[model samples]
Target: MGPIATTFPVLGVAAWSSTGKTTLLVELLPRLRAAGLEVGVIKHAHHDFDIDKPGKDSYRLREAGAAPTLVASARRYALMQETPNQDEPDLVHLLSLMEPHAPDLVIVEGFKQWPIAKLVLYRDDIGDPGILACENVQAVALKGAAPDTLEASIVRLDLDNIDAIAHWILQWCAAFPDHER
Candidate 1:
């Protein structure tokens, strides 16, 4: 219900299937850490999931009508619950839970529909022009020439050049530290 205290700015990495988004995230995260920035990651799931199983005590407790049931141990914890509404929680709500140890940057691996600044992954192999239709993309990681119709704000880069991509993200982070706050 209140604002969460956080240090790292939030960013989104978006791309179509096989566009190399995950590859980029894997490479960039450690590099960002090497630059002394603590990084947190959020991956959006497209399917139904169960972190708690039916036979588990936590699952039974929830079935018995516990709201927001939490099962914890020294090693890990799990909270299982259902929201009252059909709408999913937005980015802000999700990030608030990471507070008290918010990393220097939060890299979101999906949610391409949102307004946050993003690096759009593109591949000529995907053969789809969805990237051309995306709005608010801060840059493009692609294998070929970026379409002239693409927004002027989108900085284009060679997808194979991990160093260039990493440097571009760091620069973006430096320029928008306040966004992380």
Candidate 2:
């Protein structure tokens, strides 16, 4: 019972609320891209969010009962599906949808409780805590140093060092082969 096993390389950026998880990913993504890696991101929203506007045709069609509404343009497309029944969205299913795109790495933001191999971001000034998902946390990003009580097995990372974090992620992606599991 290690971290959640996946066929493709997946790394989760997990953190408590208001821990700047998205901000770190925003900065980390371009570095990964500059290293010539194709990356896919799946972000979980705890609050309700709306992608489509009120008067758009896609919105109208979706309101008229399209379960999965896909709008494709020449360059890009978006698929919106409504799930009112599920307690929690399935991370595996989301990963499957992105599998066909063949990204070199998939970074999952949020969904920290899903038992995936993840780097936990913690700010000592945030004051809530210094940890999340103890069993699955492979690394931890902190503003300063790791707490003395933290396990030696967990890699301590400097949150301000974007280059170092990018290097670590690249190394992680290399661990997974370019074939399916």
Candidate 3:
């Protein structure tokens, strides 16, 4: 199948561990739903993972060296394949391969280096100084003053205020409709 064309822009959540990024996402997702926009989530894992049970048919096929395994049902399906480890897939490639079911916007987690527009999440406790390291970061959901470079472009937000954060995101999305998937 050809790549799925996006109706809205793709967005990413970039933040250090324990900085409330996931918590904020949990809240933010529902608000987006209320606004009538389709949403999808993509999470990156640094380690390998198996989504199948060890003794299941699909898992057994994979363990027995099947190159590819597909598990399907009426509601959902998954395909797993073995591939050589590459440094990392680029944003476009990853999107192409994994984004067919993506909604109006695909919300990504843990891809700070990709050039896609991003919302940087930060807190004083995590002590991560790399929140501002990427060029395409459009906003920051932060607890306090962000790095000086982000002052002008960043929208300072208290992670606890789901309403404010959602409003800010809505405004940003309105201003940049082209960014939507």
Candidate 4:
């Protein structure tokens, strides 16, 4: 697929470890939903995790050499796939899978290595915390003062103001349905 993300905008929330990325997302998701937009979230996990417990049928099945064990219910479902010897998950593939759902926006958390339009959150309390030089960072949200070294081109946002942040993201989605390079 040639530049698949160009067809639909994928916004990313990037921050250093313990920078409250999840806390922001948890609050922001509802606001986005209240604004009458369907949002999809893709979170990148750094550690190994298992949603199903050992005694659970799905977990037992997966442990019994099943490559993927899908657990479903009337309300929700989860698909667990094992990738032995795999180093990293292919984000593009995940995007392709979610494309059918046709969400108004897709917000990605973590996966800082990708060249996507992202809002980087920062806190001055973190030891030597500074803005990362991610190529596609559209905005730098800060709890305190924006670093003097920050470029004038990048928009500065208030990290503690969820409504303002949400509004900025909403405007960004409207301006660039297909964003960044």
Candidate 5:
């Protein structure tokens, strides 16, 4: 595992595309927050994605060569940075960007090959090779019965049990140093 600055505890949910990663997060985030934890999220996208709409001022400003464009409003704000020719920043670099938010935990989505501890989500129909052999997989959240090949030492979780998963995440966060928490 590469050195990700341990400013905050980070737990990752890794899975192949269309394996319900985002769906699980949508359910899990609120529960984590309800438990009095401030959460930040970093998602890895396989293709170009735009949060700003065409003809929007922020989009226009970025197009006009603003390396990073910060747009703010009373309700919320966002910082969008352009990395024209640069390779995608690694997990450590991305985590550094969230330091200003000072969240208690950060849930990272995707970045399957990154060495951070992760809960590997699986479903039989995805046709992708299982990630159990991957380094740093701390647990597996399987849909339906636990696979016969699954290792007994690795924690097993039910993919459909959002409450249990959220509780497990909270417990995992507790294991991090109190200073980071």
Candidate 6:
């Protein structure tokens, strides 16, 4: 079969570590949901991580060589897959996993190198170089005053204004071809 079609809009919140990417999402998600959007999140971890707890049956199953250990409960469900000695799955593959639920938007927390349109977050105090020149960076969210060297055409958003940022994302999603808000 050919590749599955994806209709939902995807946006990445790109930033260096400790730049409040998760914190921004924590604030942004509820606003997006309240505005009647079903949002899915895809977070990329740079190191090994585990959602399953040790001694849990699901964890034991995974450790016992189950390719994907799925545990379901009345409230929610989780699927954990083992990829020992394997390369990390690319963004497309990961996004495909979200297709069944059909979220209105997918907010990616990392994958900064991917070509998806992203809002670059920065903290001037960290002194990390800006990623405005990177591919598909449509806007920048600054924690402090706008850097003097930033390009004038790039959209700048106040890092603390959750409402405005949420509004901007909603507008952007609506602008997507065949996208209905």
Task: Tell me how many clashing residue pairs each candidate has.
Answer: 2, 0, 7, 0, 0, 0
Candidate 6's TM-score: 0.92
Superposed Cα deviation of residue 73, candidate 1 (Å): 3.0
lDDT of 6 by residue, 58-152 (tens): 88888888888889999999988777776765788888999999899999899887878889898887646656566777788888877787788
Candidate 5: which pairs clash? none
**Structural similarity to truth (TM-score) of each candidate:** 0.81, 0.91, 0.83, 0.91, 0.92, 0.92
Spell out the clash pairs found in candidate 4.
none
Off by over 4 Å in 6: 1-5
Per-residue lDDT over 38-106 for candidate 1, one digit per residue giving the tens place of the 0 to 100 score: 888888776677788888888998888999999999998877667657476577767876666657778
**C-alpha lDDT of candidate 1 relative to the true structure:** 0.77
Off by over 4 Å in 2: 1-5, 130-133, 177-181
Clashing pairs in 6: none
> Over the stretch 1-181, how does candidate 3's per-residue lDDT look in tens digits?
2223445567888888778767888988999989976777778777777788988989999989988788899999888877567665445656765556656667888877776778888776676666666667777777775666565745677766789878877776666556542
lDDT of 5 by residue, 71-149 (tens): 9999999888887686775778889888988899999998878878898898867745457656777788888666677
The TM-score that candidate 4 achieves is: 0.91
Q: Write the per-residue lDDT of candidate 2 for residues 120-145, one digit (tens) a residue.
A: 88887774554643557878888755
Superposed on all Cα atoms, the candidates' RMSDs to the truth, in angstroms, are: 3.6, 2.3, 3.8, 3.0, 1.7, 2.7
lDDT digits (tens) for residues 29-95 of candidate 4: 9998998778898999988987889898888899998877778999998889998787977788777
Better of 4 and 6 by lDDT: 6
